[model samples]
Target: MKILVAAAAGMSTSLMVRKMEEYMTANGLVGVVDAVSVAEAKERIRECDVVLVAPQVRFELAGLHQIAEPLRIPVGGIPAPIFAGMKGEEAVRLAQDLIAQAAEPTS
Candidate 1:
C-alpha cells in the first residue's frame, strides 16, 4: 500500500512521514509513505492507495475528495491531536481503515 500525506510546509511533516515508515517496517508491512504539500496532493493522489490530510490543511479535504472519490481512492484528515502528537501508528491505522472501507462492496 502507498500512503500519501498532505501537509503545510514544515520539517515536522517529514518527521511524521519517517515515523509512519518506521511503523510500517516494524510491523512487516510492505508499503510506501510520502509527504507532500497540499498543492501537490491532487497530482500525486493517483499514485497512492490513500491520502491523509494534516490538521492544518483540513480545509482542503473537500477539494481532495472531489478528485479521490471518482477514482475510488479514500481521503481523510488526520485528527488535530494525532497530527500534533505525530502519532504515526494511529495515522497509519486510519489509512488502513479507509482502504478497507473502500474495498468493501456496497450492500
Candidate 2:
C-alpha cells in the first residue's frame, strides 16, 4: 500500500511519515510512505492507497475526501492521541483497518 501523510506544509508531517515508515518496516508490511503538503496531496492522491491527514489539518479532511473518495482511497485524520507521542503502531493499525474497509465492497 502507498500511504501519504499531509499537512499545511510537508515538513511537519515528516515526523509522522517516519513513524509510519518505521511501523511498516517493523510490522513486515510492504508499502511506501510519503509526506506532502495538502496541495501536493491533491496531485498525489491517486498515486496513494491511503491518505492520512495530520491532526492539525483535520479541517481539511473534507477537501481530501473530495479528491480521494472517488478514487476509493481511504483518507483519515491522525488521531489526537496518536499524534501526541502515542505508539506509531496504533496509527499504523488505524490506517491498516481503513485500507481493509476500503477494499471491501459496500453491501
Candidate 3:
C-alpha cells in the first residue's frame, strides 16, 4: 500500500510520515508513505492507495475527493488532535480503515 500525506507546505508532514513508517516497520507492514503538497497530491494521487490531508488543509479535501473518488482511492482528513499531536499509529489505523471501507461493496 502506498499512502500519501498532504499538508500546506508538505514539510510539516515529514515527521508524521516518519512516525508512520516506524509504526509500519514495528508491525511488519509493508508500504510506502510520502509527504506532498496539495498541488503535488493531485498529480501523485494515482500512485497512492490512500490520501490523508493534514487538518490545516482539510479545506482541500473536497477538491481532492473530486480526483480520488473517480479512481476509487480513499481520501480523508487527519483528525486535528491526531495531527497536532503527530500521532502516527492512529493515522496509520485510519488509513487502514479507509482502505478497508473502499474494498467493501456499496449497498
Per-residue lDDT of 82 in model 3: 92
Off by over 4 Å in 1: none
Q: Supply every candidate's count of residue pairs whose N, Cα or C atoms clash at under 3 angstroms.
A: 0, 0, 0
TM per candidate? 0.96, 0.91, 0.96
Q: How does each model score on lDDT? A: 0.93, 0.84, 0.93
Clashing pairs in 3: none
**RMSD for each of the candidates:** 0.8, 1.5, 0.9
Weakest 10 consecutive residues, lDDT, candidate 1? 7-16
Order of all candidates by lDDT, from best down to worst? 3, 1, 2
Q: Candidate 2: where is the Cα deviation over 4 Å?
A: 10-12
Which candidate, 1 or 2, has the higher TM-score?
A: 1
Models ranked on TM-score: 1, 3, 2
Instruction: Quote the positional error of residue 81 for candidate 1 in Å.
Output: 1.0
For candidate 3, the 10 contiguous residues with the lowest summed lDDT are 6-15
lDDT of 2: 0.84
Give the C-alpha lDDT of model 1: 0.93
